[model samples]
Target: MVKSNDSMKKNNILSKVLIGAAVIVGMIIFTIYQYNTAKAWSNRIYPGVKIENQDLSGKTKGEAKSIIEKKYKVGIIKKKLNIKTDARNYTLDFSKINPKYDIDGAINQAFNYGKDRNLLKKYQLIKLSSTKKFDLKLVYDDKPVNEFIDSIEKEVNKAPVDATLNISQGNIKVVPEKKGETLQKDKLKKELSSKINGEIDHDIDIKAPMQAVNAKITGDKISSINYKIGEFSTEYGSISSPERENNIVLATKSINGKILMPGDIFSFNDIVGERTAERGYEAAPIIVGDKVDSGLGGGICQVSSTLYNAVIRANIKSVERTHHSLPSHYVKLGMDATVDYGNLDYKFKNTLKYPIYIEGDASGGVVLFNVYSNNSLAGTVTELSSNVYQTVEPNIKYQDDATLPEGKTEVEKPFSTGYKVKVTKTTTQDGKLISRETITDDYYEPVEGIIKRGIKKPETTPVIPPAVPAATPPTPSAQPSTTPSAPKN
Candidate 1:
């Protein structure tokens, strides 16, 4: 019985050893399979991985990126986004906005899908990757989109036109005002974003929203302005050159027939625009520092000065005004207003209860500015006067001239006396004083008289008298006794 038990024990030991060996072999096989599978997919995306419906199974990172680019990036560049506006239709290419996709990041994510998981989890993930999908985020520059919207806005937007009055002789002609329209940019941008950021398989179509804009000055609001409230004229024909006159006419016409509503500010620079040669402004005299220089749109300052006086006489509030370095001949010392584009501007606000119409004319040697309003204020009179408080004598400036002869002098520029003047404006109704206000206290710089004197000496030639011929004398021996000797005194 003991021998039989030993044999059974040995058999049991062998059975147990065989079972252990089989289990070890099975684990080795499983580990080898897992390692082989992992190595095969090391350089490629696992099977069944996709980016936005585009399958990337068994594809390398580079291959996946190419597929995504072909499907999305290239497609986006070829697609057109159509924008419909109330006025017209606009088409924009998606490439202009620089559309792009995160293909590289998506590919990396796909490649690393099952890399960080445990053995069992990795296996399960690899198995289920056929059903799993990833998204490639779309990106683009918004600046181009905003710029496109801005361009569309400019084309779709319309400015409201104010009613204008044209006065010829005594007849008045009225031009009706027109309402304007503006684009709804915010709403349009939101609508555009939804489509641009979505699937780009087809062309996009969007409708731009719009809103109506009412005119500020309607026809009826300006039709009652018929009476001339204030008028001022400056003589430019006598002092202006042909180019200067042209500038004055152009500037006057720019402000002609303009209407200013109550509380509205008039900007001379905004109305005249830039003084460029392309805008038909000619080279004329303009004040630069203390000297007069030739520049484009030179004589427009006279137009501004004339308009200033008219505005003051109409009781309009001056918002911005600057005096010239030297007193202008066209206007009084303290009454002149100078304007330089981008540097100085002449602005005024309408302070009356009704609209005021400015009628300007630079014809027949005169630049006249007329302010018209309701006839009820016709009896209201305003007078502007200037008083010189101090005077400054100009200094003489001598300049040498080599062209002129010695001791010769010539006056290049005449002396101009500077004055500190105070301007006052008095308002009266029916001979009763309403208000007397000081308009401005201005100081004009003294301009030195320039005299050019000759520093070069004159060239002179030496004069030589002609030599008289020596008299021919008779032979001394033959004529010695011919004449009697004279007594010595």
Candidate 2:
């Protein structure tokens, strides 16, 4: 019994020694593991840290920064992020926006992961970071994006078309208003900013940024322009005067298809532009100064004159008008409206309740202008007449011409009769004289006839007298001999 008891005590002591040794070995192992792990993270990033999906494990801060900067900058700047819609597609280029990478900041963040924690907590942090990845923060300026969106807005926006009177193919009508479209710039800007910042690694789809715009003049506003308010026709021989006809055609083309709203003033010179050769005008006879001369864009006055009479018949108010220096055969005296580009212009106002469209056409041997509106003045008869109070006959004038032969006479210019006349417009409505207004009080200057007479004389021929025969010289020697002989005798 005593031997057994001693053996049990020895076994117990050996077991204690083994237990202590095992405990020491375990502590040593744990210390080595902690030291190695701490050492591994002392100058390097955690094992599981990544920058833009690029592994930055076991790298120092500088090394991680180089890797992240080089890789991420190239990928971002060289990548084309497409922003697409059904209508258009655009590319977001990082290079153009001056993209920058915060490699140092990101690397410092990754390197210091779990660095501030205690040893136990740090170990736990490292273990967590090893399995789960952390993403780096990215930043960029949105100025370029905003600017791009503004440019798109400008490109997509358009003004609405207003409803108004229009004339086409010699027919007058009303054109309906059209709605316009514009890009929603603010909305698009916000969306783009969000998209680029949220998803920097992939392309995005953007909706078409458009908004409807209403027109200022709606169809209901101009719905009253529907009838013929005034019209007149003037006869003109097409073959006799082509330049005049061409001038009429061009002026009428410019004036045609024109719409005048209520209270709107119409200026002839402003619409027709300058009459020049570059504008397809040919030289034709025009009244310049006080006489007829060939000038560019002549015969346009005839159009103005015709339109003037039509406007008068329509009962519209004339703002400005001037009679020609000489009477026009196309229209009665004191009833014509003459216009020069810079000096004179024919103007009038709509004065009516509704808008008016001027439809002019020069066809066959007639020039016609029909003003269309909602009001009908077709039954009114307008008669324009000029009564001459005093007549002035031109006198004959003479000029010297050295190029013509003597006693030859030629007519340089024909005489034109002048008159002091009063123009009247009688408007008879339903066989009753509604108004008798004096249109104009004109005084035309008389033009004298110019007769060119030859005053130059021809050169006279000079007559030469016959040459006298030379006196005979042969008697000199005989005379000397005879005189000498006589002296000797």
Candidate 3:
């Protein structure tokens, strides 16, 4: 009985050991299969976008790497998404369909590829999701880049891809704008205000430049700009800018259509145009860039300067004026330049209620300014003599080494005679001269010099065969003339 029992136990132990070994082998094979499936799944890829135009979905992860590795290091394209692309729509249809690539067990692993690229920084594909939107923003130079961002957001939350009517400065014109098509004034103002910074909130520049002098001698108040005030147009054509001229007429306009009262200051430049030939002004000399230069309008200064002096002579306050670098020969040197343009100008207060008339004309090489005012005593002015001094001439100079050949350089400028003169301006209302002022002017010397140069000549010397002293005359005595030698004396 004991032996039998022992035999049964041995048998049982052997069976248990066999079963345990089988289980271990099965587990090992299953683990290996699982690992391979996972690896395959990781390699799987869905249709992915290329940087430029490469399709990523067709390639497995390893294939993705293999394809890019050989193409080009510099141009390796990766799929991505971002806010700036202005994407219309996109999607990965992996819901009902199986993954194109047979990578391991993960069903939709193909769609996750190229997630590490820089282009993906701004966006993420919702696992198995699709979307449509207005194009994403791809670039920005300033922050909160779009000025209308907030306003747009307020009106519509969703991206709006189709909308017209926004016009930039390039498309705007002076013509009347259409309703709904034109930018809203309030909105434009708001937009400009938002874009600009600082005390004066505005986007475009409103600053004007200094161009021509203004002249307003009429005694009546200017009531309108575009309105007809008496015979002349209150609303003149227009001046382009302070630096340039506008091809239009200039009118005496009121501020915001306000009329001027007696004793009120009339600003000329603020309402009228500057002097320019295109605007019907005769060609005259003018100061450009504050420099003395001859331009289309050569004689306008005489008019302005004349008016300046006339007003001063009448004991009136002067508003705007400019003096010449060199004194003028016409209309006395001390005063000049009075013009009637739409904007750039000069103005004075009409102190007297009684009207005054400004009369000026160009005759010969002269501009005469006369002010007609109602007064019991006619004011007259005479300019006294002012000190005059001679101008110094510039020293002559050689242009250059090339311009002047070596040893041939001469004075490029020349020394010459100089000159000076003084002009006295006289103002008269009726028969008497009430005021007088003298202006002195100087002119630098002028010259017409010439240049000359000298060149060295080669030396010439006689090359007589180096001197061989003339052979001493052959001794005549020794040879003997057939006559017997006389002896040794």
- The models' CA-based lDDT, in order, is 0.88, 0.78, 0.38
Local accuracy of candidate 1 as per-residue lDDT tens digits, 209-306: 88889988888988889899998999999898999999999999999988888888999999989999999999999998788899999999999999
Residue 483 Cα positional deviation in candidate 1, in Å, after optimal superposition: 17
Order of all candidates by lDDT, from best down to worst?
A: 1, 2, 3
Error of 1 at 9 (Å): 34
The residue pairs that clash in candidate 2, if any, are none
lDDT of 2 by residue, 438-480 (tens): 8789999898899999988988999999999988865445434
Worst 10 residues of 3 by lDDT: 228-237
Whole-structure CA lDDT of model 3: 0.38
Off by over 4 Å in 1: 1-78, 93-136, 139-150, 197-201, 220-224, 273-282, 288-290, 317-322, 341-345, 385-407, 420-426, 431-489
Per model, how many backbone clashes are there? 0, 0, 48
Q: What is the lDDT, from 0 to 100, of the residue 150 in candidate 1?
A: 95
- TM-score on alpha carbons, each prediction: 0.67, 0.59, 0.30
The superposed Cα distance between candidate 1 and the true structure at residue 309, in angstroms, equals 2.0
